[model samples]
Target chain A: MATLDIKVLGPGCRNCVTLDKATRAAVAELGLDASIEKVEDYAQIASYNIMSTPGLVIDGTVVSSGRVPSPSEIKDLLLAAQA
Target chain B: MSLVDTLPSSKGKLALVGAGALALWGLAYWVNEWLWDWVMYGVLKLDSANRVVETVHFFVYDFLKIMLLLAGIIFVITFLRSYMSVERTRALLGGKRSGVGNVLAAGLGVITPFCSCSAVPAFIGFVAAGVPVGVTMSFLIASPLVNEIAIGLLLTLFGWQITLLYVVSGLAIAIVAGWVIGKFKPERWVEKFVFETKLHGEAIDPSRGLTIKQRVGIASGEVSTIIRKTWPYLVVGIGLGAIIHGWVPESFFTSVAGKDNLFAVPLVVLLGVPLYSNAAGILPLVESLYGAGLPIGTLLAFMMSVVALSLPELILLKRVLKPQLLGIFVGVTATGIILVGYLFNAIIP
Candidate 1:
């Protein structure tokens, strides 16, 4: 099993918070043992080279940025990574 | 006075006025073009043969075109001011029963002439004036969904079929989605701080007598007010779009939003947040995305997301909606956009 590392990179805005919650929900629904991290530091968020914040980084790859993904969508991403 | 009384006297006056204004507008346009030329070719010296500079020039030209459009829009809106006030809209929308009310509200929302980004004041005023949130939502969703400008550009760039699909589907999404949002009754989520400007100007009935000159003057005012407020956002949105146009690897979009990708529509919707644009600014890239074998649904989803879910608008709306409401708005809108994308894909050959 690949250990999937997921980071929700954003400042503590409401959208950021919403993305974080939905991402966690998505991970839990999939029953994946993936680790979820929130990267709130501006310097850390900037490291992703993403212009828009509130991004979702899966396994060091930016899967989505600038918007929140639904839980089911994230579940699919996690499942794809496992495959 | 009636037209019969004023026709002879007003003809020369109106003609003179029209000529003067057009000349003034032409001069302003020329100066603007010259400034842009200098900035691009001379000051920046970016008009070189380099492809990069060519793309940069494309951005500059596109920016100026949008500015000119906005200027023209401003001039027109200055004339429309007396016609499109918040109070007038509410009375027209008041006493809304469901079926036609929703459709009428949605239709009015489109022709009511607001760019979604710049419609904030009217939005607040609508909410404050006791207009149904559903009605306001209909306007909010529809106003930016389709417009004459977007339609004209799409028709010229894409085709009549695409344009027709865009208009029909855009209206459908605004109506259905707005009705759905209304069912949820989101008023509770609005922040306490949102001011509902109590005045809500008295509604004007078109049946009421007004001279053509008065009507023209009002329309002009409406055009100017809306254009002035919205011009900067349009430029910035188009500027970013041009940059996206100039760069953004084609494979990136094709891979992510390819026709066979089931996740394309939803993924594109999720991607639309944080980016802001109008339909006109995005149709060019959308055309290219289609050429890349990406699904129509995916591109449509992306267009909806970018225009409707931009982060800057959210930041601005956060000044009104609470965290939960904003999230719901984003979530619901994304769902609507994705659904519309699939609908188009399935229904359109």
Candidate 2:
């Protein structure tokens, strides 16, 4: 399996931090080959067309925006992406 | 981790539980005053007229009331708001000119799901997508200014007439302020990078394909998160309100910021501009101050300024707006709020 590229987009708000942690935990829990990156630049975040902070993007597709999904939900999203 | 997350996954059972909880909440709200009265005056034998006892009673009653109001309203608003997003709002406002656009933008701003933390990016996205600066300004102003929390509290505390007046005046401020800023030719004032930056991907609409259960889950999560985050401010605000209710003499506010002071509204707006706080923290204080003989207009202006024009939000906007544009943004919005204050003061009396 190829390594999946996941990006958490926010300017380091509390929700963003929680999302980052949840994503990492989910990745580890599922034993998936993934690299998570934090996108903090406003221009780049806007380029993704998400007007809300704490957006979750997997493989360049926005999966969640504006709110933090739970760790289990993140795992579900990750699994959906793999399939 | 929300309590909703631990519940059964069957949609029908979840809906049943939700309805049950809501019914219980209604019962609790209906009985809150009497219950507090019983505990304070009936059971404890405390004198109702005593200042200490009155203050404590006000605190207990208000704390529960505001909590219930926050939980119920936020859940409903969040659930409904799942149907709207900033991306869709921008699409609605795109390619529109200033005048009618400003009106629509202000209206949309009130309904759009936006956070101050994302203001910079949203601003960039709107402008880059051909939404005029003034229209975008109206959206930004109305987003925080005319929110559900303020509406819920104002209606609960000040009655429907005052609440309607507040909502109307808030919309007026946004519309007129954006129109005035548009006349100034604001494009030159924005940072050049905001124009130069090219959007790369298709805008994703988050509201699409959401299940009812998912929306409910989102609402419950929002209720818990916002309450947990703001409880400290709410407690402090209500505590201060309790003190002012029972202890502060009416003469103190009458002399300080009462109707007789011509500069009261502007001064309060100025003071509020620098101080950052949400409506939850400020409205309880506003209630206490209103009780202490302060005029409603000045208090409303103060609340509007604090929530709409904050230091942190300005700093964030500075990334996309030149200092000149930021100055006009603050100036125009502040002037509108001050005018509304004076207007309300004169008419309300």
Candidate with best TM-score: 2
Clashing pairs in 2: none
Name the regions of candidate 1 deviating beyond 4 angstroms.
A1-83, B1-82, B115-124, B191-256, B287-295, B347-349
Which candidate tops DockQ? 2
List model 1 lDDT by residue over B1-349, tens digit each.
Answer: 1222333237578767767877887777677666766887799777466767766676666666555655565455434433553335556777775456668777876666443433444455556656666667677777677665566656655689877887887787777776776777778877543443333223323323555565554345444544555566656655556666667766876676566678877877877776666665565567555655567766777887887778887775675567877777676767778888988777765
lDDT of 1 at B80: 48
lDDT of 2 by residue, B183-281 (tens): 999999998888887887787777777777778878888888789877887888889889998888989988988888999999999999788887876
Q: What CAPRI class is candidate 1?
A: incorrect
lDDT of 2 by residue, A22-44 (tens): 89999999999999999999888
Which window of 10 residues has the lowest lDDT sum in candidate 1 chain B?
B199-208
